[model samples]
Target: MTDTVLVTYGTTNGSTAEIAESVAEVLRKAGLTVESLPARSAPGAARYDAVVVGGGLYAGRWHKDARRFVRRNRVLLADRPVWFFSSGPLDASAAERDIPPVRGVQRAMKRLGVRDHVTFGGCLVDGAKGWVAGMILRSGKGGDFRDFDAIEAWAQGVADALTPAREKRH
Candidate 1:
């Protein structure tokens, strides 16, 4: 049987959602059945064979929706293969090197036995919501920092890891 994968994320300004979509696209190309949804609306993880959860970072914390989703589905997630991602550094540091998850995310990953996690550069463009975003933009520090190449490479790694298990199941 083919494995069904869920790529779900939480985003305040939509950048993280795009990153999740890229992940889903790569998984689909790798021949897995995949679904991408915002964490606020995604269904429980029980139906998926594996999962990729992502959230935009804010004030050194994972988005509330993403945190809640994991909390709500802890049992199911702990039993399955799971990966995580964070997008929220408006700089090239994420593409340049490994960025560890924040304290809350690190604790959650340990609790869930998550397989892996990656931090991708974030995007903050004109018209992003929030006063902080506005301030950053006004300070000339806002722009699209997401590296599609790096994101694709990381996603391919996830696909490579899952494909073997999927083939074994066949």
Candidate 2:
């Protein structure tokens, strides 16, 4: 069996956290050992066979804390299979346009040699956010755009990449 670490950035309404959890569940059901944690608390990826790093995209940028985690851990992650994802875009049309995928995350993924990368539609509830957060939320056009089926399918790809070579021979 392969061991995996799925780390992500979570936020106030917890939408991104839920997305990360769903991906972790998919990886777990695939018979791999997996760990999921907030990016601020995430550890280096070198100890694992594979890593999946996710971020909540806001204002066309990933959370600062998550970006820093990927930055500090980049060298360690380059040696492992690293998959990158962003929770973004509230609508299918915007998703097609890649709204929240800022360039920093792209650069980080490129530096780490990410095997799979994508953007998952995320969520926003006016009632659930702080004052400043709500103000910023209104400017962008997105809310709960996450497609669970698509998220799972992407995760399955990660699972396939992390699958044991011995298993592949079977």
Candidate 3:
């Protein structure tokens, strides 16, 4: 049986959701069955062979929805291959260097034994919700900073890591 993977994310302005979709696409191309969903609405991790969870960073914390999802599914996730990602650097810093997970994400990864974690550039275009987002836009700091090429490369790595296990299961 093909490995089924869940690619889920929590986003404040939809950039993280786009990143999650890119991940799901790469997994599908790698011959895995993939489901992409918002963390708030996603089903439990027990239903999938693997899971990829991502969230937008806010004030150095992962989005609340993503945090809750992990907290709710920690037990099930511990048994599966799981990856975590964070997107929310408004600059090129994430693309230029390794941006470590925030403290909370780090703790969660340790508890869940997550296979890998990555931090991607975030996007904050106009029309984003919240006064801060508006202020950032007005201040000219808002832009689409996501690096799709890097995101896809990371997803490919996740696929590579899971492929051996998938073959063994068959």
Candidate 4:
């Protein structure tokens, strides 16, 4: 049987959603049935074989709705294979800093036993954000810093993990 994977994300200016789509594509290529959705619209986690949740970072926190989804679904998530990712760091140099996920949601993630957490480089488009975001961009760090190759590699790793389970079932 084909495994089903759910890729859910919360995006501010749509970058994280694009990232989530990229992840879904990679998983699809790995032969898993994939469904990508915004966190607010996610039906639920019960039907998926694995879950991937990602969100954009703002002011050192993930998008609120994304965190809330994990919190509300904590029990179910704990019983499944789940991975989390955060998209932020507007420049390549910043990507090397390795910031942790927002502290407020760490407990839920721990309880859920998330498989892995990754932080991807982000994109900043001119005038796409609020005044403060614009100011942060103006601080000489504004561009699409996302590394698609890295994202694909990580998705492949998840696929690798799931492959063993698939083989076992067969």
- List where candidate 2 sits over 4 angstroms from the true fold: 10-12, 94-100, 136-142, 164-170
* lDDT for each residue of candidate 2 in 1-170, tens digit (9 for 90 to 100): 34556556645567878888888898888787788888888776666777777777767788776788788878888887788888766667444664435798778877878787778887776675667566756786435678889888888887777666526655
- Using TM-score as the measure, name the better of candidate 3 and candidate 4: 3
lDDT of each: 0.94, 0.74, 0.94, 0.84
**Residues 1-170, model 1: lDDT tens digits:** 35999999999999999999999999999999999999999999989999999999998999999999999999999999999999999988998899999999999999999999999999999999999999999999989999988889999999999999898878
Please state the error at residue 71 of candidate 1 in Å. Answer: 0.6
Worst 10 residues of 3 by lDDT: 1-10
Clash count of each predicted structure:
0, 2, 0, 0
Per-residue error for 35 in candidate 2, Å, reads 0.6
Model 3 C-alpha lDDT per residue in residues 1-170, reported as the tens digit of each score: 34799999999889999999999999999999999999999999888999999999988999999999999999999999999999999999998999999999999999999989999999999789998899989999989889999999999999999888888878
Task: Return the lDDT, model 2, position 166.
Answer: 26
Candidate closer to the true structure by TM-score (higher is better), 1 or 4: 1
The candidate with the higher TM-score, 2 or 3, is 3
Question: Where does candidate 2 have its weakest 10-residue lDDT segment?
Answer: 93-102
TM-score for candidate 2, please give it: 0.84
